[model samples]
Target chain A: MSGPAVVFDKVSLELGGTRILDNVSFRIESGALHCIVGANGGGKTSLIRSLLGQMPHSGQIRLEGESLGPVGYVPQVLDFDRNVPMTVRDVMALLTQRKPAFLGSSREHRAGVDAALKRMGVLEKELRPFGGLSGGERQRVLFAQALEPAPSLLILDEPCANIDEPGARIVEDVVLELNAKGVTVVWINHDWDQVRKLAHSVTGINRKVMFHGVPSEVLTWAEPKAMVS
Target chain B: MNTIYESIRLTLQGLAANGTLPQAFTYQFVINALLCTLLIGPLLGALGTMIVVKRMAFFSQAVGNAALTGVAIGILLGESYTSPYISMFSFCILFGIALKYTQYRTNLSNDSLIGVFLSISLAFGASLLLYVSAKINTHVMESVLFGSILAVDYTDMNILLVVTLIASLVVLPLYNQMLLASLNPSLAHARGIRVRLLEYVFVVLVTIVTVACLKIIGAVLVEALLLIPAAAARNISRTLGGFVAGSVIIATLSCILGVLMPMQLGLPVPTGGAIVLVAALVFVVTTVMRTTLSRFRATGV
Candidate 1:
C-alpha cells in the first residue's frame, strides 16, 4: 500500500488507422490529485479511456498498491437522450442498488441515494426527470452518483466543462474533499490555472507524456514544439 | 394445446354465461388472439422502454422488416408457409447481429446503417415474395404482412408465451445494467460492465421479440407496438418505474381494445393495423395530457 497508485509504461494506441497515442508513460502517486492537460485532439480522452480499460492499448498499466477496487467515473457530458423519462433518483438507484429498478429501490439504498444527492446539493431534484435538469444540475447529479459506493480511485474526464461558475466551484470543492480523504483522483482538465491550484502533480500529454512532475516544474519545462504538434 | 384452449374457452364461456363478455369471446380464434395479446403486450412494453431510451427505434424497425425476408427465405427453402419460424428466427437474428457488428466496426451513424439494412432487406423480401407468390396462395403473404389474428395457431401462441417468459427472465435482472450502459457507456465500462456485450445481448432480444411478434402484430406494424406505448408512457411518467408500468398498461389496454373492437364492430381491418392505430391514439391522448398539465402548471391555476 505504499507504491504509486497507477503506473503507465510506454502506452500506445492506434484507432481507425490513426496513431492517437505513442509511448506515453507516467506514474500517479497514491492519495494524490493528478491532472492531465493537453491541446485539442491531444489524446487526453484516449488516455483516460485506456486507464479506465474501456479501449485496447499497448502498454503496461499496473495498479501498484492495493488491488484496484470499484473505480468511480464522472464523464464530461451526459450522453443520453434528453427526452428519456429517467429521474435522478432512478439513476442513483441504478448505480447503487443490485435489485432491478422496476421492483422499487430498497429503503436503505434510497436513503443512501438521498444522502449522496444531498451531498452534491441536488437533493431537491431527485424526483425530477434527468432530461429536465439544466446542464449544471446534471453535472452535479453525475458527481453525486460517482461518490456512492466510494471508490479508492476516482477518474473524472473534464468534470467542469459546460457547468456554471458556482457549479464548477462545487466540483472543485468536492474533488478537494475527496483527495483529502486519501482517495486517488485522476482528472483531465484544460484549465492550466485550475490545474496549478488543485493538482499535486501534473502530466502534460500530447500523444505521449511530454512532461510529468510537480505543477510548477512541468509548467516551466521546455516542451518541443514538434512533439506537441 | 387443445387442452389449454379448451380450458380458456370454458372460462370464457362461463364469463359469457355470467353476462360479463359477448358470447363470441368463447370462439377459439378470439380466445387465442386475446391470449397472444395478453402475453406480448407487457413484454413489448417492458423491452420498448429500453429501445426508446437507447434511441434504437430504427434498429428495431429494421429487425421487424427483416422478418418478411426471413419468411420469404423460409418459403423458398421449402418450409411450411404457415409456420416458417426456422428461417424467420435465423434470418432476423443474423440480420440484427450483422447490423450491430457493422455499427460497432465502422464509423457510420446508427440511422444510416439501419437505413442501409432496411432497404436491402425490403428489396430482398420483395424479390423473394414474387417467387413465393407462384408457389403459395397470395393470401398467405397478405396475412403475414397485415397480420390476421385468426391465423395465430397453437404453435405460434406457444412460441409467444415461451419468448415472453424467457425475455422476462433474462432482461429483468439485467435491466439496470442496460440502462446504465445506454446512459453512459464509458461509465458502465469503468464499473466493469461489458458494455459492448450487453448491447449485443439487447439487440438479440429485440430481434427475438420482433420475430416472435410478426404473426400477431405483423412485420410491417410490429415496430409501432414497440415504440408508441413507451413513448406515450414517457410523456406522463416522471420516474423509470412509472414509465415502465405506464408503458405496460398502455400496451396491454391498446392490444385488448384493438383485438375486441374489430370483433365488436365487425370491421374488416387487419389486427396489426388496428393495434397500431390504438397505440397511436394512446400516444396522442398522453401528449395532450402532458401539454395540458404543463400549461396548467405554467399559469399556476
Candidate 2:
C-alpha cells in the first residue's frame, strides 16, 4: 500500500502508424499529486488512454505493483447528444452497472448519489439533464461519478478546458483535497501554474518522459518552451 | 378533401369510444396489443434511446430495410407473415453483427457497410416480391409495406409479448452495464462490464423488437417507432427515467390512435402512417411546451 500506485515501464503507443508515446516510463505513488504537462499532441492523452487500457501499448502498466482497479476518469466534458436524456446521478449510477426494477433511481442508490453529488457541489441538479449542465458543473458531476466507487487512481485529462477562472480554481482545489486524502492523482494539464501549485511531482511529456521527479527539480530542467505557452 | 384532418378527428373519437373497458377486457387483439406494447414499447424505447443517443437512426434504417429480404424469402417458401419475422430477425442480426465486427478490420467505414447492406436488401426484397406477385395478396403486400393493425393475429401477438418480456427481463438486469457501455464503452470495459457481450446483446434485442413490430409498423416505418417517440421524449424529460416514461406514453398513444381511428371511422389510412403522423405531431407539441415552460420559469412567472 505504501509503494507506487502505478508504474509504466517503457510503454510505447502507436496510433494510425503514428508514434504517440515512445518508451515512456513513470511511477505514481499513493497519495501523490502527480501533474503531467506537455504541448498539444504531447502524448498526454495517449498516456492516459494507455493507462486506462483503451489503446494497445508495447509495454506494461502496473497498479500498486498489481493490476489497476478501474481508473476513475473525469473527462474534460460530458458532451452527450444533448437530446439523449440522462441525469447527473444516472450517469453516476452507470458506474455501478446495477439495474433498477422500475423507473427512476432506487432509494439506496439515491442516498449514495446524493452524498456524492453534494460532495462535488452539484446535488441540486442531480435530476437535471446532464447535457444542460455548465462546463464546470459537468466536470464536478464527473468527479462525483468517478469517486462514487472510490477509485484508487483519479485520472483527469484537461479538465480545466473551456471553463472560467473560478471554475478552474474550484477543480484544482477539489483535486488537491482528494490528493490529501490518500487518492493518487494523475492530472494531465496544460496549465503550468496549476501544476506547480497542485503537483507533488511533475512529468513533462512529449511522446517520451522528458523530465520526472519533484516539481521544483522538474521545473529547473523543463525549458519554458517545453511547458504550455 | 382534408382526409388527414378528418382522419385525426375520427381517430380521437375512436380512442374515446374504445373506453378503458376494452383495453381492460384482455381479448386476443387487446391482449396482444398490450402484450405487443409491453414487449415492443421498452425494446424499441431503449433502442430508440440509443438511436437518439448515438445518432444511429441510419444504421437502424439499414437493418430494417435489410429485413425485407428475410420476409420475402419467408413468403416465397410459403410461410405466413409472422414466420417471416424470424427470418428477418436472423438476417438483420447477421448483417448488423457483420457490420459491427468488421469496424476495426478495414478502412471501409461502418456507414458504408450499412449503405451497402441497405441497398442490396431493398433490391433483393423488391425482386422477390415481383417474382412472387401472382401468389401474394395485394392487401398483404400493402400491409407489409405500410403496416396493418387488422392483420395482427394471436400467434404474432404472443411472439411479440414473450419477446418483449424476455428482452426486458434481460436488459433490466443489465441496465447499468448497458448504459455504461453505450455512454463510454472503454471506461465500462475497464470496470469489468463485458462490453462486447452487451453490444451483441443490444443488437439482438433490437432485431427481435424490429421483427415483433413489423406487422404493426411494417419494415419501412418501424424505425420511427424506435426513433420518434424517444426523440420527442428527449425534448422534455431531464432524467433517464422520465425520458423512458415519456417515450412509452407517446408510443402507446400513437399505436392506440393509429389502430382505433381507422377502425371506428372507416378510414382507409394505414396504421403505421397514422402512428408516425401522431408521433410527429407530439414531437412539435412537446418542443413548444418545453420552450414555453422554460421561458415561463426564466421569467419568474
Clashing pairs in 2: B39-B164
Tens digit per residue, CA lDDT, model 2, A160-197: 78666766776777777777766788988777777776
Candidate models: Cα lDDT each: 0.83, 0.70
lDDT of 2 by residue, B47-142 (tens): 677666655676767776766777777777777754566677777888777766765456465468668767987888778878667776645555
Please provide, for model 1 over B156-207, each residue's C-alpha lDDT reduced to its tens digit, 9 standing for 90 to 100. 8888888888898889888989888878888888778888899889889889
Cα-based TM-score, every candidate: 0.93, 0.84
Best candidate, DockQ-wise? 1
Q: Evaluated on chain B only, what are the TM-scores of all the candidate structures, in order?
A: 0.93, 0.79
Q: Give the deviation of candidate 1 from the true structure as CA RMSD.
A: 2.7
Instruction: Output DockQ, candidate 1.
Output: 0.57
lDDT of 1 at A6: 82
DockQ of each: 0.57, 0.38
Q: Candidate 1, which segments miss by more than 4 Å at Cα?
A: A1-4, A220-229, B295-301
